[model samples]
Target: MSETKFKDIANQITSRIEQGIYAAGAKLPPHRELANELGTTPATVSKAYKLLAELGRVESFVGRGTFVRDKSALNQVIQPQHQELDFNFSILQPCLVLNLNALTEAYTQAAETLSPTLLAYADDSGHSAHRAAGAIWLQKHGLQSASSENVLLTNGAQHALSLLVETLTEPGDTIAVEALTYPGILAIANLAGREVVGVNLDDDGLCPKHLRKVIKQHSPKLVICIPSHQNPTGITMSVSRRQAIADVIKASSTYLVEDDIYAFLNNTPIPAISDLLPQQSIYITSLSKAVSPAMRCGYIKAPDALLPVLAAHIRANIWLASPINFAAATGLIEQGTAFELASAQLREAEYRQTVAADILKDFYETASGFHIWLKLPEHWRVDRLVEEAKKRAILVSHGGYFSVGDTPNCVRLSLMSISSRDRFEEGLIQFAELLASKPMPFSDFLN
Candidate 1:
């Protein structure tokens, strides 16, 4: 590696050390160890270590190892300033407005209604009543013809996704995802040993032209997208954009997986892409986003052709979704409490969105969902703002978390879970103060 690159790597290591992940007086890993982990050579690693030792950021004692030194006095000599900040804004937690009474009541009712035979192994698909209730529940959202045969309940969205990925593609196959997609999808792709290629997105969400290009280049086995209220960015794909993406999927023989976890609370409901190409699409929507995160219930809708394969995957992995959780969801659907709770959540989300807009009006963009995407001012970088906010006991998410094609000059603020309006404002004030202050150099904590 070039000297400049070597120093860059050294600086990164020093940053980690300062964060206390690599503690002072601890021996740095062997040259070969670091080299293998970073996919670099021992020579490059050794040179970086040598530079670090010469600068006294690390001390190499004879025969022992390199140790992080006390660099408080070395502030004048490239002592990177540390910024402490809180990170409450970027997370999509479902804590603030959850109605636990409704959830518990549903679970209790399901337990009471469970058949004596339910104690035995559940049907590989799900309970017949539960599936029927699930179909009825989805019908309210505009998806039709979903009978017990079409719905399969799973442990949760993540488990359902794992089964979908395992059943749909081979180990080395690739899938197309949004440039800035959910980390859960990323984790699943990594677990399946499948490649996840990124497609560019616009205000309407995923760009059809870019998706078409990626499909041709990678010929992915599946095209996965979260069309409604996307994670992180919280932007919904418009009807026209949704249809355009559907057209692209229908044109190709490839399958589509539409993650509609965020569909429940969206006031302006877009037609499920599954409706556009039911034969070639599989829809996974879960209650984890609305009713209760503790209520681990998710449903899958697939064409008749793929049901058996998906069922087999579920059977092999987890015999079936728990009868208890399925019963709870079914009871809630039957009693209409789940829908009520979902409506309340929508009201809460809109209120929070409005408050966030009111605070960041000048900086807000035309985006829907629960998060506010704020473009950082030219004078301020996201990392600095994050750290300053932390020191003031407020937190926000950096743009790096939701970036793919190009690094955006922005950050996302999740306003749903935070309870205190005053605290939220105080944090935002700290953030604004940091933005208005003379900027400091970036540090590890900001990320």
Candidate 2:
């Protein structure tokens, strides 16, 4: 076949994809079949498919034929409806609308002050000023041991967790985590080939007794805990509970990764558990939740002994997080804009929580955080409730995503995700109505 003919075939396929004639994730016809249909040689069809693969329009498996790539995985998860109807309660982010003005000003100033030093590649860890600003950010969130020398920069909290998992433990190693935790943590552990043993969680964040048992039984090389306003569960560690958990880790000599990303949500500062075992703990926090996720600034406060390895890993992985973003972050932190934004987000979260409590008063007990861990009615299963909510354009996180072992009959509703107060309240009321109604018995369909 002529080169022009093959190019035509690729363009034809692209048009089909765009027109939805070839659906997302649907496999294309066999090359020979498609060639016959298109009145072209098999070689021409193969070339067209190859071009599509190169352009990231489709993916080919060795055994399975070429299939159109899903446009965006996030769209499937977020399930966006029309603007007036969409109530996306699945995202765990601050009310982003609250920070746009500050972010605009900050980014404008960042563009104006782009020094060659700021634009250039940074030291493996980061620029000292950026690191010092990171220290200040962590210090505000309760990591008093933070300093330029001990703190390192990461793309975000997710990147920090990935880097730590990659650096500290080998593929076959074990790590203990909260029984119910963030899905991101589970993703990191699973992808890295690390065995995750779930320690029981009580009224407090992580149960020390169960943690000691998990340490004894699984012999995890590291223990990860979310100390403040933990994900999915909304539990914060009490000071005594923090010390007790620290004592257990101190006794076991197992390193603790304190993922206090939600620390700023606390009205009163809670002293970090990392402070109890400064040498053995790695505290992670970031501006993504409060200031602006687009900036992608995250901080890690590691022990002096661990700095070199962490810095080496950061260099090996990303060379260094873009100094440009850190430059912007430094301005925010040094000038106190970051803390002020965090405070604003806290107030927003509080208001949203109150709204949630008012709507879900009878069903849910606890409040105050970015999201709620709502236990469902005995008549409603979590999967069914989630399906029902999505049917009404109300997106919520299934509790199963956050559980390590047996999945729970609960859902996590992110209050701050839907910025419109009216829409958020409406969604909550709809969700409450759904909860009040029970699914019909399976026998009813048969009848």
Candidate 3:
């Protein structure tokens, strides 16, 4: 009847389940039988069963015996939820849900007018009309010289990044990025066998002095950055910083990859680094964040000389992005619906940012963006805070998820994932409460 005996029984059951002796949905032995087999009382066996259920390994039915739970279902049940306030990844839940009807209408109209030529294989750089539409979209983002000849259509910014990496650099070449840059770039670089050198970042963004040092030391062939409303930190580069960074890139052998995915989220106009170093920069933007990700539409503005290679790479990869999706995006852009949706989302984002600022005023500061980079107190570890937040059903990303080197003692809070402003405010309040509490002892988290 001792706690040790019950815990030992629980561990044995877990080991058996893991080793496939008890497959998912398989019923465990009756409590009396299990207790008799283990030389323990039925009460002790029940305690073990309770422990197993709590660990998400088993579930008990009212009239039937306890059964091992399927791993996927167990995960879903245990996955964090905050009485409906989940601050997980940066998904435009509100935007998508609220605009579904409008999107359907727009898509239906585009589909109705679809040319039969679109049904056939199109150009690797996308249909000429789509490319032209992309050019106009790029110009709206401040890339003044963007034109159909230089624009390459893509499934999304990530696809554009893959093409750029495949064409611009060889397997062993080095690429420089922000110290805490987008994890997607890191993943792509790692997969492509490219060495990534992390350049230090300051309040404004990629520090020019550190970038110069990285360029001198690593001789990277490319540098990817998100200048406007940079991911995770929501730090937008100032005009002066952009010019300084451009000057450094102009002096180096490194080509710049401007991931301006969040450009539309900005309420004010900011010049893309591409504007300063057009020939040396590849400007990428997509409607995934601004309009809808399901549209899968993105544009890449590169030098004319690189256009052929870029198209070839596109053909080599996925052949061409879905012409149908491109048509829908093109329709939205040409009709100005894309701009309207983006403007509405921008306003929503601004309002959310204000709500967050008001809630965490004393503890944190954030710019108007999809997420906030919260600096934790020195005493709190990022992982521990993340675990504690999960316990309270509030999901957040730890700094280590985006770190290129050593993880900072911080976490990123995404505001756009949760649709309800009141729910978001509630989650922030709960998050702040956790932040204000004293750190829990390490032993308290032990099984």
Candidate 4:
């Protein structure tokens, strides 16, 4: 371990981050692995990582590894609609164009009915009417047991996840998740100083056998899964598989957080995993994906026993989720317009999936709900492909960000972000070309 050399190592790593070779939220190589690559001792690499952490360039959790940090990563990965040039297949949101009229009408109706009571501080869970609306929304999707009394409100699914992670698990406790999962879940675990262990995923989603084995080995306090249109991978769990997983949870002492945000994207309603193990599941959903991200309306359907602590966390965090947003949400759900909007979005997704399938042809393999998990050619590494895509103003999500462990040679293309069908198709054609073409030397495209 060379003490003086660690500074140079830290600077070199910083340069890599700045150059986008090591993407934001990417897990850095293990100490010994990097040490071998750099021809240095593991101790020296650890010191360099520590220095980077102190400088706020990277973050290190207790049991989890180091990660590059950047606030703009979200904006960079999930671009806004105003950027017409960038073919952003990065943001996994519904096409905003489809919902504008309905959203405006809902909000306008909400404005007319706003009273002093609606504007005041709401209860911990939220206003009864809003909760009732969330219940209706959740029940329609899959969680038929949803009711106003058990639904808790939050800014969005992300907030609900954070709130639940805080309330249910302790720092340094192990949290099990799908091997390749939503980056947000990993982010929550890392920030909370909880250890994350990835269970292998199969075509049907999380492998029930592996999940049980991980639970036994790690003795995790919590397990989180995205049962519908899973992020990055786009694998929806089968109903029997969901029951198998629920049985795994039922046999274990751990609580399962079923993030079924994409449940609305399912053609036929598949009952939520939580529906099978009501006492052990925390189900979260939101209108953001189905309606508008600006709405910020989210719901958590928890067991009655966990309600008090979860609500207390909600109270401590933001007093309560604002009733103003929930007012619009309530109006939409009550009028039977929310389900209609979701159905329209689903149809749009179906059309987009066809467009993507036609353009990508053989390259398109994953079952898309709102995104395509296009496996890359062996010649094109995930990072290199992502970097090249960005160079062409064709932004795609790097597979590294979504991995709980190693990700396959793949990049996730969010099909719903780009507003124009023509622009969207053009981006896909370009991507298909990139996938077909072999990698060029770094010097070739530097200029």
Candidate 5:
């Protein structure tokens, strides 16, 4: 039978199904009958039926004939399963286990104290008291000069990023980012129709020399960076590197967007780029990772000059950050629960990092954040490792997801997503074992 003939037959049947001529749950004509009707061989008709089955337009049964499947039902069956230890992406699930007693109490107190204000539209930037709390929260992370007037509340860091991109840049504006940085920023830039240039990095984080080169070449209006415990790579900038980058920004026309989300996870305090060059920086952080993502609370400290524009963007985009979320976050910060939870999460992360270090045996360095960047062996393929881990029921993210230009031969393992410490250790050991093994040959699969 000709391949073209079978494909034609399949296409015709698919068209009929889509047109509703073949109602869902209605059985398809028998292969022999359809072949006889169309003046084709039964084998060709069987091939067409197989194609339809693969496309999920029809299902075959042993005794029962092929029947049209409900499109929505097929979609449900094809959807990916939600697994607990699936670490293809990283998130702070340790917050799930955190005691919410304080948060509950704070919420109740906020309800009474914030009273009629909580029931109405809040200030576009934030209520003065909430912004005051945000300022204090920033100070806890070592940004000593944060003031309530300059702070603007956001739904989360991701929301703040979108707002900043829209407010600070125009379409087609170039933005400089680390060579391998947070994927979220890349996604936001792509959506906003802006360009992102990658800067090189070394052990100390963003290489100032490469940054200078990129700034000179692209003349980007903004440079986005995660200087503290950067995502995927887990490299924290040394004070010298921070100063160098700050100096570069101060000299250039570029403004800096510092994603300080992971700064709270640092065991020791590190100075933010905003500290060195406040006028040239827009600093963003959130309680989503350190406290609870449910609060949807994020804070931005831009130079006073940008406040009105940022506020305008906030009003235009989301009206205002949820007043309830702001109230909860403020209560937590003023009541000190935010600090307490952050300290506890930091300790938990350190313990998991130790576990990863032991299990991986120097293959990677685990930071005081949720993830570790695992360097692959010279011959090991990152894609194959990710696939093999999936086959073993362990999910992990490959370096390609975070790469701005070329994908690296590494994988990122998230330590805190698995709630069970023992299971997380087992997963890491399994990953190490997979790394030590050789890939199976194509001929082996054939045999």
Candidate 6:
């Protein structure tokens, strides 16, 4: 517990460097010399220097010694402004290692199909061709009643969900969501000026008991769920759970909004909960998962009656989804090219998950989606674990970023975004090493 220990000396050295006592680009004392001067082992001194070097605040030359690096450019690499809530599990994101050649070729072909005549205030719902293609896409996903009248293309699923929220409910109306749901959905609910409530879930998702309780208690106008492969938890609703949920919503007169973003990737296709309550369920799916995110084309299959309302919202908010983006997505799906592209990406994601699990099998469980959810060891809480990972120049998501109730001791590791498998695997190794490290009490070092 004394200040003379190697850890303490390391802290003192870091403090001195941060305070400009050791000028930028200046060399520090040799490991053995610092170890002797600080009254600690050379190994401990070396460990401290290694930590600083990894942070990019300092650099080391082989056969030479460690020296401070220029900190002026440190802000960009070490720190970012306006950090978004990131998770390790989102491999298919806004843009994740996009295949430029494939995307460019597809878009180029789609561009040729767009008529200059349709560019002006054309179909308020969506371009005729895009809607036709969107309907075909929906039918492949077990959406039986997806005619052009039932489908409305939007900028993205986010836009579709937003339109639904605004069109269906007024301000202060209650809307129920899965306890740990997508933050984007929550944002839409908030923007639409609705009261968002959480319905509890078991392993299979949204327990009927809790669903009924919340419905009876709040009498919410809408209940949103990701029935197949729920986000963050990756749990699918069983047939029985789905039936129970549909039954309760029918009895309670609560409408269901199914956000089936990742449903296409499901190995076993289950009937959309909408099948049971087609009159009341608003089914939304997107190509953001199956194709690439940049396509920004998603559609909603709502009750025929609500089509006008949704279209009105679309007209006011976004007039129409991008004709070019829609055509590109349509061409891929119609030509059986999207399925091929998605299959390859899914395989790559599966491989990454396997590699991550093999390296950190002792740490936690791996889920089906692109990322693995990990429970940190007893000493490493989510925040501290994140700090440890960052110290190694690796990035990961923390559990607190997802949970709303008692913050669980878990983290979602998105394996797909990184460019190289070897780099990601090495990062996973460093993560495991960080987890295996002992905690250093702040009080002991700060003194």
Which digits, one per residue and each the tens of the lDDT, describe model 6 over residues 172-247?
9999988777666666665567887789989889888999999999999999998876767778788888889999
All models, RMSD in angstroms: 8.4, 11.3, 8.9, 6.5, 9.7, 11.2
Off by over 4 Å in 4: 1-76, 79-82, 445-447
Clashing pairs in 5: none
| Per-residue lDDT of model 1, residues 277-358, tens digit only | 9899988887876777667788888999998888887888888888888788887888888888788777777876776666
TM-score per candidate, chains pooled = 0.78, 0.82, 0.80, 0.85, 0.79, 0.77
Off by over 4 Å in 6: 1-98, 443-447
Error of 6 at 211 (Å): 0.6
**Deviation in Å, model 3, residue 2 alpha carbon:** 23
lDDT of 5 by residue, 1-447 (tens): 664787789878866875668855789999999999999999989888876665445789999999987532312211232775453323434444664777787778877776676778877577898899999999889787788888999999989998999999999999999888877787788768898788998999999999999988999989999988788788988888899999999998889999999888877788888989989999999998787777889999999899999999899888888888788888888878889988988888888888888878847654557778888987676656666677777777656657776557787776776666777777788888888888765224223
Error of 6 at 204 (Å): 0.8
lDDT of 6: 0.72
Specify the highest-TM-score model's number: 4
**What RMSD does model 1 have?**
8.4
Model 2 lDDT, residue 188, Cα: 81
lDDT of 2 by residue, 1-447 (tens): 574686689878877875668966789999999999999889889877776665456789999899986543333333444666778888888888888888888888889998888877788588898899998888887888888888899999989999999999999999999989888887788768898888999998798888988999888989998998888799998999999998999998789999999998888788998888988999998888988777899999988888899999999889899888888889888899888999999988888888888889889878668988999989987655776677788888777667776658888888887878888888899888989987754323113
Candidate 6: count of backbone clashes, pairs at least 3 residues apart or interchain = 4
- Whole-model Cα lDDT of every candidate shown, in order: 0.73, 0.83, 0.80, 0.86, 0.79, 0.72
Clashing pairs in 2: none
lDDT (Cα, tens digit) per residue for candidate 4, span 1-447: 444688778878977985668976899999999999999999889888886765456889989999998523444456554557888888888998999999999999999999999988888678999999999999888899999999999999999999988999899999998888888887788778888898999999999999999999999998999999998788898889998999999998999999999999998889999989889999999998999988999999999999999999888889898888999999999999999999999999999999998989868784768998888877887756877787788988877667665546778899988888888999999989988999775434332
For residues 247-305, write the lDDT of model 3, one tens digit per residue: 99999878999998888876666888898997899999998888877788889999877
Query: What's the lDDT of the predicted structure labeled candidate 3?
Result: 0.80
Model 3's C-alpha root-mean-square deviation from the true structure amounts to 8.9
Off by over 4 Å in 2: 1-84, 440-447
Which of the numbered candidates is closest to the native, going by highest lDDT?
A: 4
| TM-score pick, better of 2 and 5 | 2
